[model samples]
Target: MSSYADLLKTPGVARIIAAQLTARFPNGMLSLAYLLHVERATGSYGAAGLVLAATSVGQAIAGPLTSRWMGRWGMRPVLSLTLVVCVLSMAGIAFLPLEVWGYMAIGFVGGLATPPVQPAVRTIYPKMVTSRQLTPLFSLDASAQEIIWVAAPVVTTFIATQISTVLAIVVAMVFMVGGGAWFIASPEVGRVRIPRSKRAFGVVLRRPPVLLSTVVGFLLIGACAAVEAAVVATFGHGGPESGIVLAIFAIGSLAGGLALGHIPVGPWAMTRRMLIVFIGMAGVVFWLDFWWLSVWLLIAGIGIAPALAVMFAIVSSSVKFSDTAEAYGWVGTGQLIGAALGSAVAGFLIDGYGATGGYLTAAAIALLGVIVSAVFKRAHPDLRGRDASPIPDTEPVPVQPS
Candidate 1:
């Protein structure tokens, strides 16, 4: 029996995870660093909040855009090229004079160039790891991301305070470049290229759970985005407090992610609990009617990682070896679209109406995800039972190779 690490010999999975972890670790740090920079420059919480919002908006839009590159060029080219672009973008942000557009541009480039790491990672599993082992592996990956991103703030904050505000941002940039480069430098995974003209994109969409999981991911992101926007505004009351609310949510998720990974939490059992938890949290946003936004967000935030880890594990299991990137790309596309929409709507509603509007919007979308998941399950009960059967007989009628 091979050890856990031995099973992960797929060059693609290891490279992709390395790139993603490095990229996200600093990207995670950027939030706190950005918040500080904005506050210091403008001396206003509202101003900083706007900056952060723009950053979030930019990143959300980037996911699918980057995923397309992943689908077309394969992980190596996509990851490498994106890293270069991100580095330049960060440099621009660091050196350019203080202004909202400057920051937005910086954020945009970073988002646009980011590798669709999750999809790449998922794509490699069928080849790198055994079918029965997928759940635990994905769990480990998800858990790693949570830990890195969660604690990254401490280092980021310290760097920003010690060296310069821009140093933290610069470090984020450098990390992406170096790490992403390293991932692709290994020929094993990077060597596997996807031809640009491989069948129509719709072909992949035809897959059952692939499409279903992707759609679910998108709707879920929409709900979460709304929650993010609303909770920040609600607990924060204006600007300075936004960081605290985000921190609360992130910390809760950190704990949840680790538990989902290490604990023998039954995959299906945890999933059901997550679904129930999602609805309950959505309900809490309105039911409690509490002015203290922190408490509401903290209570609901614990579900974030556990829910994602479950979804990812399910997604990893759903696709064939060939369809990994495509499946993952669709998932990213869903999230990108949902998050952008959520952020835009949240901004408008919060700016005009209030926190309640944003919260209601988030809750409604989350409910829709739950409803959609149910509908999909009902519609494709065949798939609900079909993947277990052997790979549909692919043997060709007798043909002579001559």
Candidate 2:
């Protein structure tokens, strides 16, 4: 707690974190909003899902390219361009009376223009604080992100159900424009410059820690998405219990991150944290009651933030400053793909085997994450007693003629 407090006290730290979180809040709202809006318009979950899938695909494709572009073109221009396009696309979706294909096309375009806020903020963090503070910053960040998962859905649900789905999206757009403006105007955006990578695009994925983090993150988030779908399926009948349970889950994550963030990270740190999640989720499989599921998921939530913190720290330590943005881009992409795949698989399984199938799918994904982390323990950088800053970019001197 003292460490986190100190981190917030650092200049630019609190402001940047708050601004980015606010800007990124739409990530939490837009998914549900899109589902409801498109479903209402097209009269089919299938069509809505196609729109969502198209949007996710556009986001995935955009993450790396846009992040790298920040290095080549500069943050303000790239972010400003994306922000304007993204806003227009959301408006098009809300206002345009189009066929399902039209919605999908616009959604895909919106995704492509999704601002690379996550990667940008993360890239800037290393420059904001001391090396020792970096790990805790990442931990604080991972924990703080739970606020989005917890509140955004509730806000979106209230607006969409009580007022209108279109209004919910409009609200999201407002946050995007407002928060994006705050973040872009920050002095740090002008201060830190990501050195352009000399290597070709996608070359950063070759780093072991980046690859390890991406694979593990994919599985971890997949498990989380599975659990979310299963919970909704279990309590989707004329009640708000599902929302309450998911909020509890996010709360648990927030608590765990604050409590365990100061602990030194070792090669096995992620494995241990993930094991806590696996054990808790495994308990949910045996008992399907509402109380039992909530209890188990809350326990699983304990490991979520801490594991993510490790991923960020490991990647930061392993990549050069020039490549950090692109590396985080790939990591973000993996999580996006994981969310899409996890929900799709959980839906298929639930249709066949009931809610238990979803829980089972979640547990299976967590188990795989555990396996990957454990087998490749060497790939995770031991951050204990070491600075977790990005390696400085270097250039070779031109050879003098003999």
Candidate 3:
């Protein structure tokens, strides 16, 4: 706790974290918003799933490309442009009276323009604090991000159910505009310049740790996405229980992240954390009652942030400073892909087999993640007693006249 206090006390650390969290808050809201909005409009969860899938595909493509662009073009310009395009797309989804295809098209466009806020903020963390502080910072960031999960669902559900689903999306856009502006205006975003990678694109995937993190992160988030769709489907017609349950789940994640943030990360750390999630989610399949689902999900949520923090630290420790942005980009892309597949598969299953299908999908994805993490224990960097900062890029100095 003292370490976290010190990290927060560092200039611009708290501000940047807060601003970025606020800016990225929409990431939490949009999936559920789209799910409910499209489901109501098109009268099918499968159609809603398609829209979410399209948006995530766009995001998957954008993650690496946009993050790399920040290195060449600068953060403010790239972020500012994406912010405008993304907001407009969100508006289109809310206001445009179009067929399911129209919504899918706009969702894809919106995803392509998804701001690289996660990558940007993460890249800035290395510059903000000491090497020793870096891992804890990652832990803190991961844990804190649960705030988005905690609040976004509750708020989105309330609005979508009580007022209108369209209004829920409008509120998300407002957060995007306000929070994106705040993040862009922050000094650290301007201060930290991501060095252009000398390595060609896609080269970062060659690193074992980066690849391992990307794979495990894909499975982990896919499991999470499945749970989310399941929760909404279970309680979407039952009032605010969906929001409350999801928020409770996020609260559990926040608690776990904060409690486990200072613990040393070993090669098997991710596997251990993922097992916790798998066990909890596996338990969820036995009972579909409201209380039963919430309790199991709360337990599952406890492992989410800790697993994510480990992934972030491992990637940061493995890559060069110049390649960090792109590495994180690939990592983000994996998660988005996971979300897309998880949501789509879960939606289809829910339509056929009911909420049980969604829970089963989540448990299966989580179990797979655990197995992958354990098998690749050799690839997970032992961060204990080691610096977690990005490898400094070596520049070639010109030879002077001898």
Best-fitting candidate, scored by lDDT:
2
- Model 1 agreement with the true structure over 234-320: per-residue lDDT tens digits: 766444465565576666666555555433334243335346446545665554344345565565556666666656655555544
Leading candidate by TM-score: 2
- Cα-based lDDT at residue 38, candidate 1: 68
TM-score of 3: 0.92
Candidate 2: lDDT over CA atoms? 0.93
| Deviation in Å, model 3, residue 143 alpha carbon | 1.0
Order of candidate numbers by TM-score, starting with the best: 2, 3, 1
Expressed as tens digits, the lDDT of each residue in 276-383 for candidate 3 is 999989999998888998899889998999999999999999998878888899999999889878887998999999988999999999999999999989999998
Residue 359 Cα positional deviation in candidate 2, in Å, after optimal superposition: 0.2
- Candidate 2 C-alpha lDDT tens digits along 275-371: 9889888889887787998899899999999999999999999999889999999999999999999999999999999999999999999999999
Q: Comparing candidate 1 with candidate 2, which one achieves the higher lDDT?
A: 2
Q: If both were scored by lDDT, which would come out higher, candidate 1 or candidate 3?
A: 3
Off by over 4 Å in 3: 38-47, 233-236, 351-353, 396-402
**Cα lDDT of model 1 overall?**
0.61
The candidate with the higher TM-score, 1 or 3, is 3
Q: Could you arrange the candidates by lDDT from highest to lowest?
A: 2, 3, 1
